[model samples]
Target: MNPGLPFLPQNEPSGHEDEGEPTQTPNLEVKLAGEPALTVAEYVSLRTEILKLIELQAQLLSLALLSLGALLGVAVQQRNSNIAFVYPVLALILSFSWLNHAHAIHRCARYLVEAVEPASGGALGWERFVRQHPLPFGMLGYWGVRSVFMGSSLVATLVGWSLPHPTLLTVIAGVASSLLTLAAFVLFLVWRESSPKQLKVEGHPGSTA
Candidate 1:
C-alpha cells in the first residue's frame, strides 16, 4: 500500500464517507455600480416628510369635496336667495383643493426622485413605483377632479350674472353638476382599473426547493 494511503486492516470504516461534511457557502457582497450617499435616518426622514405632505393634502382635498357637497345641498334648498353665492364659496374651496392637489403631486414626484437617485441620473422610469406609492395617482385624480369643479364653479358664476332666470340657469347648473359627478366617477374608475396587483414572494437562504 502507498504510504500516503491508510491501509484497512480488516473491517471497513464504520462512519459513512458520504456524510463526511456538508458544503459551505462563500460570503457574497451585493453592491450597486454607484457611490454611497445619504444616511439612513436622513433618507427615511425625507421620505416620511414627503409622504406626510401627501397625506395632509389628501385630507384637505377630501374636506373640500365634502364641504362642496354640503354647500350644494344648501344651494338646492335656497333657490330664490341668489344661489350664485354658493358658486363663489365652492370656487374658493376648489381653489384650495387645486393647490393641495398640486402640492401633493409635487411631493410624490420628489419622493420618487429620491427613491431612484441612487440608480443613475435621477429618473424613476415608467414603473409601478409612481403608482405603487398611491399618493401620485391619488393626487393626479384629485387634480383632475378639482379642475372640473373649478370649471363648473366659473360657469355657474358667469351664467348667474348673464341670465337672471334661475329656472334656465338651474337646468344648466344641473347638467354641469351631473357632468362633474360623472367625470369624478370615471376618473376614479380609470385609476382603479389601471392599478396593478401586488404579489407577495417569500425566499430563504440555502433552501433546497
Candidate 2:
C-alpha cells in the first residue's frame, strides 16, 4: 500500500484484475503545477515566430516601395505618362497589402504579450518591443513614408501634366485613391486603439520564466 495515498484502496477483489485495474486519477495539484512550464514554452516559441514575421514584413515593405520607385523612373525615361497613372494605382494596392500584414503581426504580438506572457510568466521585453514600434501606418512611420511618397506621386500624376477632358479611367483612379486613403486612415485608428498603450518594459530580465 502506498503510504502517502491513504485514500487509495488497499486491496481489490482477485477477479478485478481481469476487469482492468481501477483508473488512477491524476493529482490536480501536480497537473496544474506542470501547466505553467508548458505555457511558457509555447509562449516563447510563438513570440519568436511573431518577431521573425515582423522583420520579414519590414523587408518586404522596403522592397515593394523600391520596386515602385524604379517603375516610376522607367516610366519617366520612356516618357510614358499613362504609366504614371498605372504606377500609383498599383502602389496603393501593394501598400494596402503590406498594411494588412503589419496589422496581423501587431495583433499576434499583442496577444502574446497581453495574454500568453503574463499567464505563462512575465517576459516584458517582447511587450516593450511591440509597443515601441507602434503600427506601421501611424504618423511618421514606415507606412507614412510609403503613403506620402505614393500619394504625392499620385497627385503629381493627376496634375503635373495636362490632358484633354477627364476620361472615365482618370476619374475612376482619382475616386479609388481617395477611398483607399480614407480606409488606410481608419485602419490606423483601429490598430492604435487596440494596440498596447505603453512602450515601457514591465519586468526584470533576470525574473523572466
**Candidate topping lDDT:** 2
Computed on alpha carbons, the lDDT of every model, listed in order, comes to 0.47, 0.57
Model 2 alpha-carbon drift over 4 Å, by segment: 2-33, 123-125, 128-139, 142-209
Question: Can you write out model 2's per-residue Cα lDDT over 1-209, one digit (the tens) per residue?
Answer: 34588876556556766776664545766788888888777777877777787776677567656765776676567655444455555555555665666667766766776677778555445665555555554435644645553564455355424333246775665556555555545544554323222332232233322
For each candidate, what TM-score against the reference?
A: 0.40, 0.57
- Candidate 2 lDDT at 39 equals 76
What lDDT, from 0 to 1, does candidate 2 have?
Answer: 0.57
What TM-score would you give candidate 1 relative to the actual structure?
0.40
lDDT score for residue 119 of model 1 = 51
For candidate 1, list the clashing residue pairs, or say none: none
- What is candidate 1's CA lDDT for residue 74? 58
**Residue 79's C-alpha lDDT in candidate 1?**
43
Taking the tens digit of each residue's C-alpha lDDT, what string does model 1 give over 1-209?
Answer: 22465442333445654677432223221233223333334445555766676677667567666655565555555542246435555555455554555555555544444454435344323322443344534656544655555555555555444444447666566556445545444444443312212200111223332
Q: Output the number of the TM-score-best candidate.
A: 2
